[model samples]
Target: MRECIRCGEQMKEGCAIRVEGSATGIIMSTKENAMFSGRIGYPKVAICPKCGEVSIYVENVEKLK
Candidate 1:
């Protein structure tokens, strides 16, 4: 569970962040040349309904390392 930084409330997790007008979501990569090489990951989101705060994180952190 995630906690809202602003309100100190429990945040709703397991949400996904997507690009506008695109099916693909946000990506995180460890390599400088991410398009061709290195580890990649899709970020997940946690939102606070009380204060409208949003937090992003990578689920597959091991993959990026």
Candidate 2:
């Protein structure tokens, strides 16, 4: 059961949120920069309907390594 950190209310599983590298689509670094390379994450989300708070859950953090 996910709980809203901000409002302390029960949260309901909502959707999958896509997370990407911070430099995505930004041509500020060298072509070889790993920061600009594509890295993605799909984390399940939970939301508190009453307070409109959101939470993200990543099943495997090693995938980001």
Candidate 3:
């Protein structure tokens, strides 16, 4: 388990987490019921436990390559 950056608390898997990504753009059109015709952003990301901040870049996200 890894500790959260904002809260310094342990981050467990299978737990509910916040995700950050682009809004009305290309990425939005690929999601369920997606209606946008532009690039959205990243698929999804997790938020900070203490500050609840979402941090995830779609363009930079990969399979840990």
Candidate 4:
């Protein structure tokens, strides 16, 4: 376990993806100003070793229960 950046308490990762079977999420565009959807892509993510900060950028996804 690790502490948060704003608070020095035990921090756990909030869900990056909240929608089950959700294909897409928020996107910002300056030139296009468009919102893209209907594409299934569940990106893999992991937690930091020291801080327990989770980020999604990996190439593989793991299922845990």
Listed in order, each prediction's TM-score against the native is 0.75, 0.49, 0.28, 0.28
Q: What local distance difference test score does each model get?
A: 0.80, 0.62, 0.46, 0.43
- Residues 1-65 of candidate 2 have per-residue lDDT tens digits of 77789988988885655438664432222234563453343456888989988877764556456
Judged by lDDT against the true structure, how good is candidate 1? 0.80
Better of 1 and 4 by lDDT: 1
Quote model 4's TM-score: 0.28
- Evaluated at residue 21, the lDDT of candidate 2 is 61
| Sequence-dependent TM-score of model 3 | 0.28
**Model with the higher lDDT, candidate 2 or 4:** 2
lDDT of 2: 0.62
Clashes of 4: 0
Model 4 residue runs over 4 Å out of place are 1-40, 58-65
Find the 10 residues in a row with the least total lDDT in model 3. 56-65
Instruction: Give the Å shift of residue 48 in candidate 4.
Output: 1.0
* Highest lDDT model number: 1
Candidate 2 deviant stretches above 4 angstroms: 18-41, 61-65
Per-residue lDDT tens digits for candidate 4, residues 1-65, read: 43545445554443354556777653332234332332223444444556566655423223211
Q: Give a tens-digit lDDT track for model 1, residues 1-65.
A: 77899999999999987689988756677876774466566778999999989999877777655
